[model samples]
Every structure is written in C-alpha cells, then in structure tokens.
Target: MRKERKMDVDDEQVQVMDLEAQQKKTSESDLPKIQKKAKHPVILKFKDVVYKVKFPSQRKKFFKQTTSSPVRERVILNSISGVVYPGEMLAMLGPSGSGKTTLLTALGGRLGGNLKGSITYDGKPFSNQMKRNTGFVTQDDVLHAHLTVTETLVYTALLRLPNTFTKEQKIGVAEEVIIQMGLTRCKNSIIGGPLLRGVSGGERKRVSIAQEMLIDPSLLFLDEPTSGLDSTTAQRIVSVLWELAQGGRTVVMTIHQPSSRLFYMFHKVLLLSEGNSLYFGSGSHVMDYFESVGYVPSVPMNPADFLLDLANGVSPDESEDIVTVKEKLIVAYKNNIANELKADLREEENEEADHRKEANTEIEKWPTTWWQQYTVLLKRGLRERKHESFNILKIAQVLIVAFIVGLLWWQSKITHLQDQVGLLYFSTGFWGFFPLFDAIFAFPPERMVLAKERSSGMYRLSSYFFARMVSDLPVELILPTVYVIITYFMGGLKRNAASFLYYLFSLLLSIMVSQGLGLALGALVMDLKAATTLGSVLMLTFLLAGGFYVQNIPAFIKWIKYLSILNYNFKLLLGSQFKPGDTYPCDGDTKVCLVEDFPSVRSVGIRGQFVSAIVLVIMFVGYRLIAYFALTRIGVTRKSRTTKSWLLCLD
Candidate 1:
C-alpha cells in the first residue's frame, strides 16, 4: 500500500509539470517569438462588374457646360482582380490623400474613368445584369428627407425587388433588415428634419442599410461608413455591418477614424496608410508586429488610431527609417508568398465568375415595355415637378397686370384714332409679362432634381414631358383666366363685349404660346445665365416683331412674325374686335378723324377665339414635343429607366 501511494504521488507531480509547461508555451507564443506576419483567408470570387462613370472636372471656363470639354482621361476598371471571400470582410483603407473614395467610386461604376481592367464576378466578365446583384451605398444617405422610415424601406422594396417577391416577401425583407440592423425602435419615424422630428443619425444610417438590402445584394460596398457619425453611432453602424457579414454576404467598407467599438466589430483589418498597404489579416495580430519594432501599443486604446499615429509619423517630419519601415511593412503584407497565393486565388475566382456569367442565359430583368415604364416614371417626375410657388407667383402677376392695364385704359379718353392706337400699345405691347419667369427659374431646379433622379433610375424624360404638359395646363390656364376676366371687366370702353372677350382669349393664347416657347428655351440652354439671356432675347424679339411697334418687316423677317407665337395670337385678337365703318377720321362735316380703323387697310380678318386658340395651342404642343424629343434624346440619361424598371418588378 505504501509503495502504491508513492507511485500515485509521482504520477500526480508529472501531470502538474506537463500542465505548467503547456501554459508556459502558450504565454511565449501569444507574444510572438520572432516578427509575426498575418495570413490571408481564401478569397471568394464575385461576378463581373461593368462600371462606366463620367466625373465632371472643374472647367477653366463656363463654356465647357455648353460646348463639350475634352472627355476626361477615363480611369479603366475593366477587371478588378481582388476576390473577397464569402466568410470574410475586406476593408479598403488608405491615407487621407489616397484615392480610397476614388477607388470605391470607380468600383461602383459611379465615376466615369479610364476602365481598362475587367472586373469579373465569379469567373466571368461583368455584365449589366451581374452588377444588379451588387449593392453600393454611398457615403451620403441618398434618401428622400420627407419620407418616414417605414415609407422609405417600403418604397425601396417596391422599386428594387423582383416581381417574384410578393407583398409578403417585401414585408418580410424589410422587417428582417430592420431587426438585423437594430432599427426596430424608430422604424416609424421620419427620415430627416429638425433633430426632434425624425429618426436619430444611427437610425437613418440603418435605413440606408435597409434600402440597399432591399435587393438582397450578394456583395455590398459601403463608402466611408464612419464619415459623419459620432463614435458611438459609428460603432453601432459597424456592428450591423458585422451582422451582415456573418449572414454570408461579403462586406467591403472604407472606414476612417473607427472607434475601438468599431475596431472590435471587425474580424479582420486591412490597414492602409497612404496608397501603400501597412497590414492585412486578423486585427489581433497587429500589436505583435509593432512590438517587434520599438513601438509598444498602449492599452484601452484604439489600435487603428495608434497604428495611424505611428504610420503618419509622430510629427510632420518623419525619420527616414520609419518611412522605410512603413513601406517594408506594406511590402511584406501585400508582396510576400502568402499575398502571392491570395492574388492567385483572386484571379481564379475572377475566371470562375466570368465563366458562370458567360454560361448563364441572360434574362430580361427590366419590368415592362420601355414606353410603359417611362410612362410611370414620368408621372412621378411630373408630381415632383409641380412646385407650388411657380403657379402662385404666375397667377398673381397676370391678374394684377391685366387689372391695372384695363383700369388705365378705362380712365383714358377714346376721343381719336391715334389715341386708340396709343392705347393698343399700352394694353398689348406694354403690360408686364411676368409669367415667362416660370420657364426661366423653374427649369433649372427641376433639372437638378431630374438629373439626380434620372441617374438613379427614377423616371423617363417622355413621361416627365407628358406630365409637365398635363400639369402645366392648369398652371397655364390659371393666368389666362385671370388676364381675360380682369381685362374684360376693368376695361369699360367696350365696343362689343363678345368681341372684347374674343380679344381677351386671343391675348391669353398669345401669352401661353410665349410661355411654352420660353420653356423650350429653358430646356435648350442648360445654364441659368445662358437660359435667362436667351429668354430676354426671345421677349425682345416677340415685342419688336409682334406688329404693335413695327408695322412691317422684310418678307424673310415677315416669316419670323408667323414663327413668333405672339404675332399670330395678337394679330387675330386685334382683328376680332373690329367693327366695320365704326370709323373715326376728320370729325364732323363728312370728314372722319385720323384714326386706326379709318384707314383703307383697316378691313378685319379673323376675329373668333378659335383662330388664335388653334394657332397658339398648336404652337404650345409643338414646343412641348420639341422639348420632349430633345430631352429624351440628349438631356435625360438611360440610367433613370433602369431604376424605374427595377422598381416596377417589385410592385
């Protein structure tokens, strides 16, 4: 028994010693024996990308807006070689001056550049359809500020989803993203306004996330996720991204000044300082590399921040060795045997993406016929186009101008022909034509919104063109109604009110025709200054050639009078109210007073409302069509229809 006890004691001591040895080994290994290097996980191949973006450079002169400037030397991204794997999250990190945003923008196909490299999805080259599966959320939240959280998500779902995703599917998709992103609390709140009125910044960020996720993108790229948010909020945003990465979707984010919370959210970190890479792989391995050098990372600190401080240099002036050290670190991370393997793997993935894309039959992803889709898009555009201030200002000007002019005419004595002719100048040629301002000021604002929405696939120029015509009818009619009624009542020197009413209608038609022409002028000249100048020129031309001031012009210029919408309408108006032999020439004794009607050429032509209305209304229609065709062909973009097409399928 004593011998057995001694043996048991010896065995127990052996076990304890073994345990201690293992612990010692772990402690030493965790600290790194020599310099430590990180390893790259296998990269997953994405499908192809087709990114063609045009980035407008600041021109030396404004003339570049009208006359084309040299197409910028486009950056080519024909094929991006890096293949981020399914289980991994790759961060594009760079120095402040480095082209991180530029790269992101190029990758997303938002910026037009020289794209030489072919970016493959799996193994196949990129196609339009392949790109549809990828979601890119820009740094700024591109959302309608007026919409509530639910409204936004629902809208996105409606627009982006396929027809196959039924109402339940949409609701389910939105709800899932909301839960995953921690947006449950403020899902009902408005997007933005006074801080008190809407969702918090964090919530808005999630809403953006939910919007992108509406299509269930396989690869999601977020450009500078932490740009405008507070540290805590930024961290929260990162956490949601981590949650997404865990769900098997690859996430690539360009992050700046990440809080420790954000750092912890990342499973891997690719540290880029300047255009060169500093480190890649597990974030936990970062401290060991620095420790090998003389720099010791402090505790309770953000390692990313600590690393950047060292990488940028302690002061403006960096020692030669530190600069060399940063370069060497980057070279080791990106150029070593491990990196070679990662590169090879990425290439293979690219080839596979290409093969898959090329092999698959292309499906028509667009929702409906081109015309039908545009019709829907136009309706939406038209609704947005009807800004309230435009009509309000126009109607007020018309009523006030007509009333004052008529009152002045009523007060004046109609004693002689010259006096009546002078009054004709006061009524037609002299009255304020402020309604033309609508075309001048309005087109630019609508143009900006249209450009933006069109870029995103919001609507078509044709639909917007038609809607503008339809909506503007009320807008156009309002002024004419005011002008006609006010002038008819206020001007008491009426020969025959039925004839006077014809004059009012004719005047209304003339103004509307001018307004349409002005709108066309606005669309033609993109710049506000140029458009304004053109508008002034139009007004001058009409007033001069409109027969009030100038009785006769050259035969060639006389044709210009026919072209002058003002001339046709105004001519019919004056002719309509003429009463034959209602003459004034030399007064008394069978000698009529010198007068406009007493002239031999004073015989009336057409006086009916139908004549002027037909001419002016036809002119308006023709002008609108000209604007539509020009815009549809040149002014509007093809991308607008794409987004709308994507939206309709969701519905």
Candidate 2:
C-alpha cells in the first residue's frame, strides 16, 4: 500500500511539472501570437466623467417632523479622466469605496446614473458595434458549475460568434483560446461550485478570461481580476492580461493592493480616493510624481501598498494632517497630470478621425439566429441540469410518495365511494404541490448567468425562455409519470385501457401546469426563499378550493376556483374515475346509489372534462408567458434601451 501511494504521488508530481512547462511555453510564445493577426486595436479615452446617484434623506424638524424624506444626490465618480491605448494595460487602484469599480463600469458603457461624461472607443461614441467587440469580466465569476471548461467555451463560442463562421470554425476558436489561456491541462474539468470539487481557483479564473477571449475582443474591462488570490496566482493572472494587451487589445482592470512585482506589470496606473483622481500616468513614474508633490515614501514598500495608504489619507509624514496631504495630492493632479492626459487624448482623436468614422458606421447584428440559439441553449440546459432532474433523491421522493398513497388506499373498492374519492384528491394535491415547490427555485440561481450573457448580446431572451421551457418538460415529467403508473393500479382505480389512458393524461397535464406555475413564480420573484413562500401559499389555496375540502364556498370568493389549476385538474381526475349514473353499494343493506350524489363527487362534477383540459393547456402557456415577460422587465432585454441612452450620451 505504501509503494502504491508513492507511485500515485509520483504521477501527480509529474502531471504538475508537465502542466507548468506547458503554461510557461504558452504564455511566452502562443498567447501573444494568437490574436495579433486578427486584432482590431481600440484606444479607450474618457474625459471629465462624473456619476451621481440619488438617495432619500430624512430631515428632522424641531417642532414637527414629517415621515417623508427628500431626495439627495451623492457623487460616485467626480470628473475622473484617463486614457488607455492599445498594447497597454491600465490598472485602477484604490481602497474600498473609492469608486474604482464605478469608473470601470462607466468606461465599459455599463453604468447608469446621472452620468456626465465623454467616453469614446477609437475616437467614436459607444455603439452596438462597440458593444459586440468589447468584453467585460465581472468580479464574481458567473459560471455553470456542472459544465467542463471545453463545453462551457464551446457553447459560448457557438452562441456569440458570428454565424458566418462554420460550426467547426467556431469550435476551433474555442480550442485555440483554451490553449492560449493555458487551460489545456484542465480542459475537461468541471467548473465546480462551493459544493463540488473541480478545478483550482486560478484555473477557474483563467477559464472566465478564456470565455471572453474567444471573441478576440478589441477592448476588455475586468473588475478586480486578481482578487481573492495568492501573490503567485495573482501575478500569473496579471501576466496573462499583460500578454493579452501585448496582442494589441486595450485592457483596463480594477485591482486592490498588489505586491510590488504584480504592481509593476501595469503599464499605467490611476489612483483614486473618494471619487477623486490623485494621479493618472505611467506606472513607473508614479513614485516620481508622488515625490515631486512632496509625499515620498520614507521606507521601501510596494507601490500598490503605498498608493493605497495615500488614498486612505495615511500621509508618509505622520506629523502632517492626512486630510491636508490628500487635498494637496488631488489639487496637484488636477493642475499637472489631468491636463497632460486631456492633451494626449485630443491628439489621438485627431489622428484617428477617419478610422473612427468607419468603425462607427459598421452595422450591428446578432451573431446567431434565433433557432440556432434555441437549439444550442436547449442542449446545454439538458446537459447542465440532467443530474439534478434525475438524481436519486428526487426519484426516490416520488417513488416513496407513490407507494405510500398506494398502500394507504390499497385495492380500494368502488363500494367504498368515499375512500376512492379521497385517493383521487390526495393524488391531485400531491402533484400540485410537488412540481410547484421544485420549480420555484429555477431562475433565482440562474439570474446572474442570464444577465451576464444577455449583456454580452449572446442570444435573444425569447430563445432562452423557450429553450428552458422545452428542456425542462421531458425530464421533469418522467418522475410524475412513474408516480402515477405506480399508484394507478395499486390503488385499484378504473382498470380499462381507456380509463387508464385518460387518468394518465389528466395527471401529466396537472404536472406540467404546476411546473409552469413554478417557473413563473421563480422568474417573477427571482428569490428562492420568497418564491418558495409564495408558492406554498398558492398551492395550499388551490388544494383547499379543489372541490374536496370545501363544498360551499361563498359566491363572492368562488371565482378563485376558476383560477385554481388544481380545481380544473381535480375535475378531470374525477371524470376519469367516475362517470354519469355510476352506482355504488351503500350501507344498511342498501342495494345501490348514485356516486354523483356524494358531497365529494357532487362538488367536482364529471361534466366539462374537455373544458378542464383546455384550461390547463392555457395555464401552461400563459404562466410561461408571464415568466418571460417578467424576466424582460427585470433585466434581460430592458438594458438595451439603457445602452442606447448611454450611447447617445457619449455622442
């Protein structure tokens, strides 16, 4: 056993060495050359960009205070200005709440507020074409945990790459990006989550970068790419970004305090404090700039650490007031570095006038067709969610419920009219709640991924909505079908082929309608706990009004039954089991009686079975439509109008 363990350890070590060598080679040679030939260089320039948000403020009165609060504006980015040219990586550094991320978002054309600014790409205003060619890497990696690195990238390529490229070509691009990002070693590993063990954190971050790199974007913006990483891993990530910039793509990233080695990788640095720019110039010149302004560091320290200290109002000279030092730095930057940056930006604008016009005139179009998007999304949804849908826990729950219902009403006789009716109602109520509670959790977790992809203009909201609906139908229905099959015969309901077929159809329709309600609730709320709570209330109401528990509902509130999915479903199930004039043996030596006269049977009459099915069908479609529209209202496509307004502002 000891020898075997040693052999396994040796194998792992060898793999690690091989991976390191491959990564080194790729970073040195492959990455820089990968996109150089196809690169479209962009110069990102922003001048006098100011962003402010409104918040409610309550004013206390000495005599009588009102409950209402007036609105007040707070500045987030105050006249911040900088420029980043192709082949340069600009790092924005500051402490928390310094508006580093806010500025980055503004430059990426994603910020919305009372934003006053001029942000241009290649001397042109923001446009749909510019959006297509830009990449924004968010701080939280929004990725599906079940997909492997290759699968994730390939699907992204298919969805986002232009349709002119053959499917095979798009796939090749994904593979090339995988190699360029040095992800070939873990190409087949899952992008795991908190509960699952998959790739290392460094590898996962690389995969996120690789997804954006597949398009060979001319401009890239990352919000704290090196956050939560060790010094070595952070250095490696910045190294990759440096190589990407070297390939002629302008890169801008917000980074927190970095080591000296990592700090020097930035070509230019922007130091911000309280929404004010303290310095904007070459990274190497930051120390000199600070010294010239009479704030030199007394001891050797990492530039990032020193800069952060100054931004936090920690003066190099402890005797000097920190607030005075910060004010002096801000004033000095406005007088010196800010003017130089504006001059450089003007010169570059004049130099690129013709190129800017041509770039702005380019037409905008989706990369893939609606049908293609639907198909790809459907396949991906199935692959990612199949395990959850068919896992042992879910299947066992359904089976257990089925067996319990069957045993409790085992071989119930038609003479026992009450027992038979009770079994039908229990089945109806079980399915009604089972599918609903399961479905309410669908969209909350996926909201992040949806927003990320939709912002990138990957696919249409309609395509994604329909794909989700279709993909869930087949897998979601299987257990319900199994449950019905188990309980139908064991409970001794009608034994004929026609009776069984009608019974199965009714149950299946109920499951689907219930599942649709779940999706609608999930999408509408987009909060797991809130949606679950709402679903519980709704399912309980439907169950109570389903014609079994309550026979004499008030006329004013009886209309709720029309809206209850369970009401229609119970009617269909009753019709399937008991028909008109069906006689059942009665107690006290009675010969026969009409089943319809019973309170349970009379409440849910056998009439209008066809109408009930039609109502269910409508509910299924109507609920999904509500979900899709709710998603639109929240964020999916609503941002397009915001993007247009942002573009107009740049113009």
Candidate 3:
C-alpha cells in the first residue's frame, strides 16, 4: 500500500508539471505573433565605419594612447554593414552606451560626426532617392514651440515636401498624422519639452513620430522613444510604432525598460551588452532562449527586464542561472553571427576621398538648394527672436541708455581734450558695442533653437547667419539712432547739421560692426554659460584694449588696438567732428595730428577713422566665418562623427 501511494504521488507530480507546460504552450499560442518576414533586415550600410571621437571621458585616454586629442578615433564598424527593408520594424535595443544613438545618427546622414561606413540608403550611399525618403528623430524633440503643431508641420512640409505636394496635399498629410498619433484633440498643441508647457509627455512623443512620418521616410530611426514615461503610456507609444510599421516603413528605435505590453510590439529585438551585440533576433525567442538556458521569469517581470538582468549578471539565488543564461545568449549570438571585434575608424579618410570624387556630382537631387535652406532657416530664426519679450525690453533699454549717455556727455562747446577723448571712447565702444552685446545675449536662446534645427535639415547655416544680420538691422538702429538724435540736439561737437548727420551715420556704421561680432559669438560657443562668459571677456578686452580706458598698451601690443572694434568706430566718427581749420602740432607723438593740438577737438586723431572702419569690417567677416565653422562642427558633434562628440554620449 505504501509503495502504491509513493508511485501515485510521483505520478501526480509528473501530471502537474505536464499540465503547467501545456498551459504555457496554449498561452503562447494566444499571444500575437510575428514571422521572420515581418522583421526588417539591413539593406545598405556605411562601408568603412570610423569615429573621429569617443565620449569625453574616453578622449583623454584616447589622446594618452594616441598622442593626438580629437584625432584619436575608433573604427566602430569596418565596412560595417546594416540594412532596412520596407514593411518591417527593426528595433536596435541595446544597453546604455552601446552606440545606438550613434548608429541612428549615422544613418540619418545629416549633421553626424565623421563616419566611414558606407550607409546604403537605397542601393548606394547617400543616394538622392533614399535621402529624399528618410527621416531621423533624435532623442530630443526638435520643434518650434511658438508655432502650433499644425503650423510647424505645415512649415516643414513647405520646406521639405516635394513640389508635387500642394497646400491641400500638405494639409492632408499633416491631418492624417495628427489623427494617427491621437493628437486630433490637441492638433494645434505645442510639442513642448523642458521649460515649456504644452501637450503631455505621451502626446509630445507621438508628435515627434508624426513629424518624421510626415515626410514619408522609407526608414525611420528613433533614439529612446519610450524614455521617461509610465508603462501604459509606453505601451501606447510602442503600439503606434507597431502600427506605423504596418504601413511599410522600416522603423528602428532604442527602447529602454519596456513593460510586457510594450515588449511584444517589437517585430525583432537586437540585444546589446557593453557595446557587444548579444542577440539579434525575435523577442519571444529572447525569453524562450533564456528559459531554455535555465532562467525563468518570475510571476510578472517583463521579458525586456529579464533579458537585461541576464546580460547584467543578476543571479536569482545562490543556485540561480542568470550568469549562465546571459553567457549562453552572448555565446550563442557570437557563435551564430560571429561579429566580435574592435571597429576600425576610417571615416575621415573616406570622406576626403568621397568629397574629391563627388565634387563634380552637382549637389544630389534635392528639392531645395543650399540658398533656399538658408532663407527658410533664416526666416524661422527671425520669427523665433522677433517674438521674444527680451527684444521689446531691449528697445526700452536702448532709449534709456541713449538718454543717460546723452545727459552725461551733454554736447559742450567747452571742449576739454579729455572730453573729446571720452566722447570718442564712449560712442565708439559703449554706445556702439554695448548694444551689440545686448542684442547678441538676447538672441542666444534663439541660437540654441537654431543649432538644433540647423543640425537637422530644417534650414541652412548661412541663412541663419545672414538672416540674423538682416533682422538685427532694426534692433541695431534703435540705440544708435536714439543716441544720434539726442546727441545731435545736445550740440556736443557740432560743425553743422550735416556734420551731425555724418557723425550719426558713422555711429550707425560702428554699431553694425559690433552687431556682426556679437552674432558670430552667439554661434561659436556650445554652452550658453561658456558663451556668455567668453562674450564678457571679449567685450572687456575690446574696450580696455581699444585705447578707451587706458592710453595704450606697450608698443608690442599696440597691434591689439588695431583689432579693437572701438578703435575703428572712434576714428571714422571722430573724423567727421574735425572742423576745416584743424591742424595739430604733435608733441612728437606723431608727425602730424588733426586733434592733438586743435582747439575744437583737441585729442582724437581723424585719420584713425579710415583705418578703423577697414579693420572692423574685415574682422567682422572673419568672426562670422568662425561662427559658421563652429556651428557646422557642432552639428557633426551631435551626429557623433567627431571624436569630440563622444562627450555627449549619454548612458
């Protein structure tokens, strides 16, 4: 009887185990399924993968090993290949710092750092047909808040969409995307990020999706689409992505910590650990493989979580299988695909070669020209800044400053030599340049916006640079005009009304010179804090170094005075104040001087005007070019093509 009871218990145990197995099989059968055909495969890729930079932390080490700072690069994917076919979604899910964003950026071919791998957009690298149909959404939402959702999309369509798309066609496309993303209710909402208040996080995420889809890209790459959202919202976001995939565009994204509902939406999952490709296959297989290797998901943990745990070596207990399971996946992937090696960096050399070869290729078949890009970007930039409250305050501040400056240096026939020198200094440097500084600082935030847009293909750099110059004309004239009217009326150095007007014109010219300098500065620096500090330092050096506060530096540094913006403004404008009979007996300081001994204006030399204007204009152009180059390099940084770009690579 005891033997029969033991046999019966054992039989019951086997029966219970078999019943649980059968239920799991039945449950899996009920889940939504994806076939291999639904999963996208790599079609085209960059041939020689090269990264001119690493993350900031890695740069110093890279330099230490390489003896060159920024040039120290790594080949991420030599003749590195990847593909994206139509009608499938390939999710490049990876651990943090596995170059997911870098890869996505490289594929976009817009504003990426140096890259060597030949990314075959549509059969060939940078094929006109492929570029026209591809869109990339970065981790950050790059949208103009001032423009409502509909307007932003409309503007994008106007700028990027083919001429075949009419106003009605554009609106139709925009409306479809709006409803598809569940933005029908807040269709006019602002896709706001930090410091902005508009649509909720979930809606904003979808808006980013809509913006990319509006262009009808053949392949879309999104980095961290579901970051910083709740499980339900994450699931909803992924579902939209899945639905988008159903429409036939190859969608790829880096997803982190997805819920179970979210996990199953992916057609294929590429698991990465420590920059190593661990698995590149199905999501269910992701869990099944782990289970087969001796790990099981506890009651409610999502598969994504369990996969990460295995990869990170999170043991369930003393006798647990997490370590062994993770190793099994890594080994299995490595064995199957056989891709475990350091990537060689070679983009720079290849780019130089490609530039030489493509030099005659008459800028790929694009709907717009570089000039058009600039114009649109410039118009948008103007819109961004023209609406800023700071600009209005600037007008008020200019009037107050002009009034105070006029009162302090009230035009006097009692012309002391120091008074003349002081007037020249104040007008050339302060009145002219301080407003420039204010105009620039006021526009810095807008510049931040421009950098984001320009980095993408929203507009051209030259357009933003030139448009700012044109837009600032009114802002530039405000203080100089006010000062000119006030000072001319005050009758400080009046030869005649004509002389006053001439001086006013010279002052306006001086202000313009300063304006150019400020715009250049706003574009050159990466961070606002750094740019602001540098601007302060530059302005101070220009003032003190321009023979304003101090007489002059030693003969060795007198050349610095020539570079000073104020020096030029002072000379040109002061020449106007010199009356006809003015001749100076030099105190051996010069062979002949116009104001050194003249009674009307006894200290400011007149010819300084001609020399200063020439120098200031030249310096203005020079500074503007520097600004452009800096902005371009920054765009490349965002794309992680530059070794310096790695600094921004986040975990």
Against the true structure, what is each candidate's TM-score? 0.67, 0.90, 0.77
Top candidate, metric TM-score: 2
Over 1-651, each residue of candidate 3 has an lDDT whose tens digit, in order, gives 445535544654564466445434532342222222322232433443444454333344543565544434443422333444566666776567656665666666653555564555433456445555666766766677766677666667656766677757877878776765667777777655477788888777777777877777667778788888887677666666665666666888777667655666666776665445566556545655555455665543557776677657664442656566556666776555434321321236666566556644543454656676566655665665565524667667766767786677776543344565566567676664575565456445665456555544555666656776676666567656776777656547765777777788777776766766666667665456776677778777777776555563688877776667776676677667664456544555445554644532332356555666677678767876766676665443334444445643444
lDDT of 3: 0.61
The order of the candidates by TM-score, greatest first, is: 2, 3, 1
Ranking by lDDT: 2, 3, 1
Tens-place lDDT per residue, model 1, 224-264, is 87787887567556655655665667677877667654554
lDDT of 2 by residue, 1-651 (tens): 445535544654564466446446656753433445326889898989987766667687888858888777677788888889999999999888888887887788776657887788877777778888899998888899999999999999999899779999999999998888878888999999999988888888888888888888999999889878897787778878877887888999998888776666788999999889999988867877887787766665667888999998898767677798789889999898888887766645455676666765766568889999999999999999988888889888888989999999899989778898888888889989888987787788899899889888888999998898888886567887888889999999999999888888898898989999999999998889999999999989988888899999999999888989888988898889888888888775478888888888888788888899999999989998888888885443314343333332221
Q: List runs of model 3 lying over 4 Å from the truth.
A: 1-85, 107-126, 166-172, 191-193, 318-327, 336-365, 414-421, 432-436, 439-458, 491-497, 583-595, 598-604, 637-642, 648-651
Clashes of each: 50, 0, 30
Best by lDDT: 2
Error of 2 at 81 (Å): 1.3
Error of 1 at 50 (Å): 13
